[model samples]
Target: MRGRDEDVISGRIVEVEAYRGLEDGASHARFGRTQRNAVMFGPPGIAYVYLVYGMHHCLNVVTEVEGHPAALLVRAIEPIAGAEWMRAARIAWLASHAGNRSAVAIARGRDRLIAAPVTQLASGPGLICAAFGIDARDNGTDLCDPNSMLRLEPAPSEEPPPEIACGPRVSIGYAAEPWLSMPWRCWMKGSPALSRPGPKAAGTGGTDSARIEGTEPQ
Candidate 1:
């Protein structure tokens, strides 16, 4: 693992999705800044959390200029530490929703239900939150502070396979037209891990999903 990975994993952040900005129809800032979006006025590397669906919490990182609320939605992460504890937490939640032993088994015992390795653990925002044990309590945490648990790390120095590409973000149907097409989502070019098949070219439009693509796990 590298310093950057640790920065993102250990840091605290309540998951809150951002919908671009005022210029974009999908952004929360579309209506302009108020008390709730004050953080969006700050520089990059700040948390921008909000409640959605009147129930779930989503997380985002403020990026670009002070007023331009561009943010990367932390869709997932590869688990690093506290794997078992994270798994237990998720399992407990699943168990509670389970109505029978079979359902519990299916929920708790399935391979998908198991905690993935630290490297593969938090590949998505929701997975990242679960892997690092983040919850509503972590809302409004600072990510830029080195002392803070939540921080963004530069992607690994080594180059990933030339096949990486970018595409539209996944599961964001609510984001209107252009916002949906903005190529912000990244992933391995042709790796099987990609939920959707990537283009034939080299690193172009897919989201970057590798924790440390060219380097082996330490």
Candidate 2:
């Protein structure tokens, strides 16, 4: 992403969750397209940013053909560059979120953001948005456009691709049986940047559908 001043920040996406509209019970477009989810129904390679918990922003990439409404939620990313800028942005967000705009509080937040491991700087979907200053304003952006402020890029091929693992999506207690239990979430194996280190497979534990955490309606 490039800030207004041309400050660029970049990261490698490490985890994602696929959502198939209407057919997928956990998808935002399960009920068909609305004003909020219109981007998902557009052409492929568009951004579908949304706010969750009234504050945190989550980013998704639209996939499939027009009107298909398929997307991949960017669940986690590994920060690659612009550490200082990311720290400042994250600290500003943390301070604003806490409603503690005091200098001391902001300083403390900056310290924490700076001290955090680079892999964790943009680890979660929300954290990545905060660190890179992405939000609803970026929704519907053409992610395939090279000139876009927040655009997707091919990964550098100097290193081998990391092995990937698949597991059930997280915090979707309201979704029905098949969708709720589907192993649609993919992540790089052994990546410490994942929001949750160990993904729970279906039948590994109880199907207690009452434990939704850190999530709102899709």
Query: Highest TM-score: which candidate?
Result: 2
List residue ranges in candidate 2 displaced over 4 A: 1-6, 100-110, 199-218
Model 1 residue-pair collision total:
37
Q: Give me the overall lDDT of model 2.
A: 0.82
Report the Cα lDDT for candidate 1.
Answer: 0.55
Quickly count the clashes in candidate 2: 0
lDDT of 2 by residue, 1-218 (tens): 55433467888889999898677999999889899999899999999999999999999999879978889999988777786778778888887787647878777777877789878888888998988999899998999898898889888788798867677888999999889988788888768788877445524544422232433243
Model 2 lDDT, residue 66, Cα: 92
TM-score of 2: 0.84
Candidate 2: give the clashing pairs.
Answer: none
lDDT of all predictions: 0.55, 0.82
Residue 203 alpha-carbon offset, candidate 1, angstroms:
15
What is the Cα-based lDDT of residue 189 in candidate 2?
A: 70
